[model samples]
Target: MKSMMMLMLLLFLMPVQAGTPISEYENLLITEVVVTPTDAEMIEIHNKGGVTLDLTDVYLTDATFSNGNVYYYQVVSGAGGGGDFNDFFARFPNGASIAPGAYQTISINGSDNFFSTYGVNPTYELFEDGAGADTVDDMVEATPGSIDDDPGGTVAGVSALSGGEVAVLFYWDGNSDLVQDIDYVVWGDKREAVDKTGISIDGPDADAITSVYLDDTVIASQAVINASSHAGGNSWQRGNLNEGNETGSNGNGVNGDDETSEDLNNTFFEGLPTPNAAAGAPPAPNLIINEVDAVSSGGEFVEIYGSANTSADNLSLVFYDGDTDQVYQVIDLTGSSTDSNGFLLVGNTGLSPDVTIADDSLQDGADAVALYNIDASAFIVGDPVTVNDIMDALVYDSGQADDAGLLTLINPGQSQIDEGSNGNAANESMARCPNASGGSLNTSTYQAVDPTPGVLNSLCPLGDYYATADDTNATTLRNTLHEIIDDHIVFPYSAGTTDTWDVLSFADEDPNDSNLVWMIYKNNSYTWKGGGQQAYNREHTWPQSYGFSSGSLGDDNAARTDAHHLMLSDVTYNGNRGNLYFDDCNAGCTELTTDVNNGVGGGSGTYPGNSNWFDGDSFEVWNFRKGDIARAMFYMDLRYAGDVSGEVDLQLTDNPGDIQTGQPFMGLLSVLIDWHNGDPVDSIEQIRNERVYSYQGNRNPFIDHPEWVECIFVQGGACTTVGDDLIFASDFD
Candidate 1:
């Protein structure tokens, strides 16, 4: 019974058939070598992989071909197929195996005196750098008893090398068909340096005493190492504790620091190489739900980054309502992986999610998303889950964890939950900054940025050049700002359809759909796929007939398309409003045209303002829209104030119909100022200001700073320098 049990256990633990290719393993590499001078030739191989590997089919070749002159020497004798590698150099014994994280030193033919320095067996290959003049290598027990492999024989250098030609090293993994070219180094393109395509060529020149290592990945992209990259001595050795391949680092470059241990902290350092060891911060979570765009107009999404040396096997993204403990969705990431740069996106499938999650799982504001290392089958709502099993947990905000005010990070040293000025608002998403640096997920790490679901965050452009804080006298501030964002360029009248749509969407909502839309004319929303609108057209809030048409005397000018005064209203309403003027529609105000008396367009409707009354000729903007209209009128006033042609010097009055017909003034500065104050600044207007500013390169100081309207028009704040040549604005108080 005991014997049967033992046999069964052995069968279960035995290695599976080699269905997977060698490339599927982490990696094995040719870490270092003494390539220059041939006499004391030797090269080092490392099992940088996670598991011990059988070397039966693996082989190494020291060869160079130039001018059709093929020079070759092989290691692992019969393994180098039979081509240019016809000759045998030094070889590994029959069934030698390299334990995980171990190194094999093969010493080629050299002085016996040097070989005696280390007790471990070392074999050799015949690959020379630059013939008789090649650089000599330093030999010693780089660290005694470090390597435990047995020694082997050496083959002679086929030909002495001179400087120009590159000596190539090919470490192929396979027996029957040398299929896997694990790694190769192409140095010095001087002579017929036949660069074997398909691998990254590392470094410009070869000079360091240590092995030139690949700084970013497992493969060496260069054959040069910084002197400081090595430890006490100059041998670029393997990581101790078997963490990962020791890589070099540039500023903020991927470091050996997988965040696992200090030993594997970074590739670049000034210390003795700690061979065969574990080190670094701790591997960045293999995959992290680094960013989430829960509030988006198009669709919600989650972005992930792979920061460790692991496969995307059983990984899954789960979304939950922290309050309900109800698991909503599970997105299996099986076989899905981040790009070489460690980025993967998942969410609304239409946005091209790598592994789509149920759209309902994603919700706006206050939710928790976790990267679970387990499979979906193991996940259950209300089931107890341990943080130890979580690769990363991004809690949107605190929601009763042990009754704590803030959700304590299960592994929080860095940001784990998106916090701070992440103004959890509509159409915005929180994302990691300086990305993939898996630390604590807090405000500093994850920030509220514009929704950039499938890509990195592009923070809203808040330039220092624009005026923001510090309000001054409205008139003075207005004049000061006018000089800055003044008329730089204006789109053609033909461009108004697109521009007007943008303006409309910015400041107002489409009554028909409530979604921001392109209104070609009132009651008509322009469809990009369809033809033009019917009765909808651009209505100049400050009419065009006041000597400021798209073209003066018929030449299309900026005023014709300046978005500040452009609006989309019913053709009937607009024609009714025309160039008449704006005034109080209540029975108290004068010039109450009979148009209103005769059952025309005066209504208690929900528009322009809470004041839903319109005068006959001068239409009354709704109370809600009053401020929006007032600000636009004010912007139009200031924008053209400095026009090159003094012909359109408009006017402003405090009374209805007080100005003559041909005069430029819109009317009643007092009324406009009152309207500005009544409506005040709101988000809709602010959005309009931002969008319009983006296009016109100008701002309505009135909307931005309503108080400024009072300061400039009421507080006697008009610019005295440019006195008359103006009207009511010249002398204020």
Candidate 2:
């Protein structure tokens, strides 16, 4: 029969090389394999260990050996069956070896085809002679068959590998007839058949061919390690090959079969074929989409944050439209980089972007802005959104329905962030609070704020902090605010460690001069000479004499030393205004002049012309600081309730007669309310609130939300409405 003649030819063609085993045989791995586009077919092997490995006697084959017979499926050209048996397998010739951390690629379709496809020569050529200069190692091939014969159903040859195949790398020692299976990988549906059964060919008795099924007693069980099939032009590669050496095995102690599919769903990702190189995706860029301004106005832009002065070469900013769920534009950032402050921008003209696009390029809502570590040319304008090589993304909508495809790019459990949720004006932009605080693909940390391109994002107002506070009713809102800000970390008035003075030094520090403290009453800057006999002393805006005088409640009285009401003041002015209720003075009051600068208080002589006034029984603050003084008094009334031991229940009243020493009350509340409305919060007051919050761990609600004032004070617990009407009523009352 023709099968017998072809078997004889296979024996004659294979050169008898002495099968010598090397100790480093276990260090070899079949890293990658490409079966489609036959001319580009190749197999990549890796040397994972530290030393170089001699590959002589190493066999790469698709044939399965069973009981002294080789079972293989032959393919000649494009068709199956009746080809040279040698074309189905290959062996590493003498002097063939791989260095540590190096890769050796075997060109299954000859060196010319591999070079034309990948623009690089392969390490070895299997189907052609290696007399050419491009071949790194000459591969030994099997002999041609004399007669074309069909040997049942067997699939062989790397080019013929189109799913349902297994590639094995092994070492053979001829002296003791020992065979060591190094690596094995089975793809597609052939795993079950390969593990269960094989065909048997009786040696010289040609007609004695039969199928051999495995039984428990005679079973030659081989470990099965499944891999992905070649369907979408993707090759199966060892997972996490770029991270470190792979330790997963084919349930055997062999090196080549180290990759298992236990976490295939999570770890597997699609990518282009990489011949003779590291596999898997490259490292993602350390960057994020920090801010976005996508209003109807043509000034829309996106900000990126990353390490300072790092190059953004090959990174791209892609915009997706909600209607089509496809990319609309790709801004190439090949020549761009983050500035010294770690910020970069892509926007319309006049915004000074690092990369500029056309006006109105960004959709206002129900869209996405994604940053990817890929070239811009590779992106198609109408392609669906993909997570491949994506570094960061923001899915947003103004009032439109959420785009499910755009949402898929973000982290799980996080929904699309609405640009209009926080009631931002047309000129405002959505920014990541606290800079880059959130993890990758997360939008929970963003908030609408005044756009601050190329700089740190503004600390968003603490709206979520008051989520449990009842704002519908005035009394409930006040009580809820008290509970939210109560039990904060209390620093000592004066101690061997960090005290109230240390906090005030930073809290009341002159914005222009770090060495000076801005004195509250004098409205001027002075050098901070620490506590006793100093040029400035701590003035209690809500005087301690009325409720918590020095030692009346012992050293633990938080109300007496509270930094919210305590301010740095000139020493002489502190005594002049002692225990006086705040009220506007008429003609005969002593006029205390104020200095210019510090953004407030700079006039003289005339009654209350940006100057402090006093009439022995009452003190009036200058024009700019009236709101600051009123808010401090409001905090004291809310903070202490006498419920805790050694604490006082401070109250604010319209009658000055109720403000007696040793009593828990402060007055002329009607004048204080007028002062609060007359002088709104400024930059100085906002800075002071933030500084005090740093140490005390509580904020003055009036500084953050000025609208809450009328609700709690004038509405008498009925705070159902907000806006100009409530403020207008409070102004007249």
Candidate 3:
């Protein structure tokens, strides 16, 4: 029994015929190489095959010779009398393996030095002594009597792996004397024959060569190679080579190398070193034309977004005119880099730009601005649109015809952005909302917002905020909008901490003068008096008596204190327009005057002029703020559904009897719709919307999408046309 067991053990240990050898040359790819900062050198290998790879008996070396025939050898300890070349070459330990689609980084210098440089430990270290106390695995050393073991002369291993040296990975069975070269890479200079003495050899007069061999057969020769000596924290990385070779194609020939020297040079790029990680494509210029204010004024500027602290050298911002679809201006962006927050502003003089151009250099619109990865000199005036090197582009027009030729360079399927669609292009600048999102070259990501040139962009809500709202049915859309804006963070009407007063103070503060408040009723600015009746007061645009009375629920009433419908008003004007339904009153109404600032409202006397007019039963907000008041009414109608305990179901109608009775109803709905359509959202309204949202955590959907008012109230509502006038269902009831 003992003799049978011994024979079985011996049979199990004996080498069997190699069944279908793994084609490791194509499966194990040399991905990255860092050859400088001697102590931090590294080589990264990737397992592109589908199955895990057993690395046992695998060898890595930097020595190959071909005088009479190609002969590959391993480094040994005490070679050339006393040189310690053991750390230069590595042999895989018994259980070493690499999983599919994973990376294995071998620290050529030392594990400690690699960790110090890359901030992460390497997978395996060639020198056991270099690992120190770290948990990094160590590779086996070459045999002591290997081919390079000379007794007398001085021999050296690839300690620095300096430029012009080749690194090769192979598999060898010492017992059977079978060798198969797996991968090879050489850099810094073209291949040239060298004498054996150059590598401190003593026996054969063979010449050292730069080539790959498989089972002693020459497969590839490095006649032409990458001549770049990637030093100073840069590395040569493999890219696109494994794209079609993932399933293992051994080069273009049957018995040739897996990749040629030309393939290596074309695919690899000098990129930041990535140890123990997949080396992707080298960093291309990742800049986007983030913001543009081509207002023809002095403050015109363009903002760019990119990786923080990265070089912006050799980049240019080009402007194209719509008429000819040609280059109009080019701003050189050399010698500038992104700030710590990844923003770079190129503006006219006096705007503190990272790069400065002449004032008013940017055209207003029917134009385009593009960022390129080349120099400004590459572009000339009147040159036709060039899309080859465009990194990002924004084709825009101020309500003009689309520039079809220029739009082709932008993101696929996106149209030319209309900067004037918001109706206040001069006071606003086109910016990428949510700040640098929505990918590159996409004009759909931009919105006309209050200009914020050198800082983070405004957080404008996306147009899809009411994505689930049912537009086909008016009641469904109204209900969906209510759900979206409900459950808000309510603040007390007056409190020691944040309150309605605090919200209105910031929401209504003059855009130009922060110390003054813009009165909604009077259309003028007043000293901010902290809710004092003498200076300014909070006017519930949808008066509280209609649905949400402050006397009934006090400060706990959300609808009563909601900032969306609240505005700063002159204390006396707030009384003059008390609890009246919004309507257009003419001839017999008392007119209140206005003062203009921030590009809104400064006129008087005429029937429908930019002045507030009021009668006993109705009040007409100034033309400049009609949309503001109409949107407030719309918000009230949607916000209070009376589902909650203290809430009331408010409604809008064209009936004066319903509003006069004050039974949770307000308005002449037809006039409000006309007002909303006539006065589109301006910058002041947008700023005020953002401010109110900051405190109340809710937004007026009408202000965000004024077109939805007609979608929900006019086309979708239960209405009848009587003599070309549309009246709501409540009017008949």
Indicate which candidate wins on lDDT. 3
- Give Cα-based local distance difference scores for all models: 0.47, 0.69, 0.69
- With a 3 Å backbone cut-off (N, CA, C), the pairs that clash in candidate 3 are none
Please write out the lDDT profile of model 2 over residues 1-733, one tens digit for every residue.
8999999999999999643336566778777777777777778899887777778767676544332234322111112212344235556877688889998898776788788888998998765523445535656642233111226523233354554456667665322212345655554333212232232222222344542322211111221222335555566565434312234443222332333222221222345678888787635546899998887476788999865445687898888998888989888898887774468988877788888877877788799999999999889999998999899999987767888878999998777877787676366788776556576799987877778776666445655766676776777888998998788667556532345776788789998998899988888889877655588888888988888975476433688678889999988888898989999896578878788867667776877688899997899888888899998888888888777886889999988789888888897888888888988988889888876775566778888877677778773634544344765545555
Candidate 3 per-residue lDDT, tens place, 1-733, comes to 9999999999999999563245543578788888776777888999887777778867776544432333343221122111133224557777788888898888876677788899998898765544145687776655543313436632233454664566767665553222445676666432312112112222222433333323211222232124447757888887645532211333321234433332354346678887778776555556788888887478888999864444577888889988888998888888887874467999988889998888878887789999988888899999999887788988888788887898888877987877787898778888877567567878776888888787656557557656666654676777888998887767556532235776787788887897888888777788776744456788888888886775555434788788888888887889898888899986699988777777767775777777888888889888888988888888888888888787888888999888844478888899999999898988788878777764455678888767568656785444222122333334543
The stretch of ten residues in a row with the least summed lDDT in candidate 2 is 215-224
Q: Model 3 clash tally? A: 0
Q: Which of the two candidates, 2 or 3, achieves a greater lDDT against the reference?
A: 3
Each candidate structure's TM-score, on Cα atoms with residue i matched to residue i, is 0.35, 0.39, 0.37
Ranking by lDDT: 3, 2, 1
Best by TM-score: 2
Model 2 TM? 0.39
Q: How far off is residue 623 in model 1, in Å?
A: 48
Superposed on all Cα atoms, the candidates' RMSDs to the truth, in angstroms, are: 22.3, 26.0, 25.4
